[model samples]
Target: MASGALAKPQMRGLLAKRLRFHIVGAFIVAVGVACAYKFGVAEQRKKAYADFYRNYDSMKDFEEMRRAGIFQSTK
Candidate 1:
C-alpha cells in the first residue's frame, strides 16, 4: 500500500549525479578498451594473412600434406 512512501526519496542532486557520471565514464572507458583490443586483433590477423599469402604455394602445401599422410591416400 505505502511501502515505498517512506523510501528516503530516490537520491537526488550532486552525489547521485556524480555517481551517474562516474558510471558513464567507466562505461566509455570499457568500450574504448574493447574497441582498441578488437582493432589490435584485427591488425594482427591482417598481418598474419598478408604474411601467409606473401609466399603462398598451394600445390606445394598440398603435396606436403599428402606426404604427411593427411589424405590417407598414400600418394
Candidate 2:
C-alpha cells in the first residue's frame, strides 16, 4: 500500500514534465511559422516593387515629375 502511494506521485511528476516539454515545442513551432510568414510577405513586397519599376513608362513619369519640382528639394 505504501509503494502504491509513492508510485502515484512519481507518475504525476512524470506527466507534468512531459506536458511542459510539449508546450515548449508548440511555442517554438508557432514562432517559426510567424517568422516564415513575415519573410514571405517581405519577399512578395520586394517582388511587387521590382515589377513596378521594370516598366519604362513609370520611370519616364517619375523623371517628368522630378523635373517639374513635385518632389521635395534635397538642398
Candidate 3:
C-alpha cells in the first residue's frame, strides 16, 4: 500500500547530463561563431588593402620626372 514515490530514483543524474550537454554545445557554437567573425573581418581588410594598393598609382607622376635624372641609374 506504500506510495510509488519512493520507488523511482531522483532525476538529478538526467538533469546533470542534459546541462552538461547544453554547456558543451554552447561553448562549441561560441567558438565557431568567433572564428567565423574573425576570419570574415580579416578577409574584408585584406580585400580592402588589395584594392587600395591596386588602384593607388604610386608612380602616376613618374613620367614627368623620367628625364630629370632624379631617378636615373647612378651607374
Candidate 4:
C-alpha cells in the first residue's frame, strides 16, 4: 500500500527528467537547422547572384532602356 501511494510521484519525477533531455535535444536540432540554412541556402543565393551579374553591362542596359523610351530625359 505504501509503495502504491509513492508510485505516481516517482513516475512524475522520471518523466520530468526525460522531458528535460527532450527539450535539450530539440534545442540542439533547431540550432543545427539554422546553421545549415545559413551556410547552405543563404550562401548559395549570394553566390548565384554574384555569378549572374559577373559579366553584366549596366551601360548597355541603360542604352537599351533609353532607346525604348523608358527614360524621358538623359542624365
Candidate 5:
C-alpha cells in the first residue's frame, strides 16, 4: 500500500512535466510561424515597391515632376 501511494505521486509528477514540455513546444512553434509570416510579408512589400519604381510610366512622371520644380530646394 505504501508503494502504491508513492507510485501515484511519481506518475503525477511525470505527467505534469510532460504537459509542461508540450506547452512550451507549442509556444515555440507558434512563434516560429509568426516570424516566418512576417518575413514573407516584408519581402513581398519590398518586391512590390521595387517593381513600382521600375515601371517606365513611374519614372517619366517622376522626371516631369522634378523638371517642373516640384522638388526644388527651398533653401
Candidate 6:
C-alpha cells in the first residue's frame, strides 16, 4: 500500500492544474499577437487613405476613371 502514493488523487489534480495553466497561457499569447496585427493593419490603411486624399487633385488625368474603379486589379 505504500506505493499507492504514486496514484493519489492529489497528484492527478496537480497535473490537471498545470495543464490548464499551459493552455490558458498559449491562448493569451495568440490573442495578443492577433490584436497587434489588427492594430498595425489599421494604421497602414489610415496612412494610405491620407496619401490618396492628398493627391486626389494632382491625379486629374484618370479622375473619373479612378473613381469608377477601373484601375483596380482583381488579382
Which candidate number would show the highest TM-score if scored against the true structure? 4
User: If both were scored by lDDT, which would come out higher, candidate 3 or candidate 5?
Assistant: 5
Report the C-alpha lDDT of model 1 over 1-75, residue by residue, as the tens digit. 656655576565879888899999999999999999878898889989999999999999999999888997667
What TM-score does model 3 achieve against the real structure? 0.46
- Candidate 2 worst ten-residue window by lDDT: 1-10
- The C-alpha stretches of model 2 lying farther than 4 A from their native spots are 1-10, 46-75
> What is the clash count of model 5?
0
TM-score of candidate 6 to 2 decimals: 0.46
Model 3 RMSD vs true structure: 7.9
1-75: candidate 5 lDDT, tens digit per residue: 455544445664798899899999999999999899878887889988998777659667878888888987621
Clash pairs, candidate 2, are none
State the lDDT of candidate 4 residue by residue for 1-75, as single tens digits.
455554445664798899999999999999999999999999999999999899889999999999988998873
* Per-candidate local distance difference test: 0.89, 0.82, 0.80, 0.90, 0.82, 0.81
TM-score of each: 0.61, 0.45, 0.46, 0.63, 0.44, 0.46
RMSD of each: 7.4, 6.0, 7.9, 4.2, 6.2, 7.4
Clashing pairs in 5: none
Candidate 5 TM-score over all chains jointly: 0.44
- For model 1, name the residue pairs that clash: none
Cα deviation of 4, candidate 1, in Å: 31
TM-score for predicted model 4 compared with the true structure: 0.63
Q: Between candidates 1 and 3, which one is better according to lDDT?
A: 1
Residue-level lDDT tens digits of model 3 in 1-75: 876665676676898998999999999999999899878898889989998888666566565566566676632
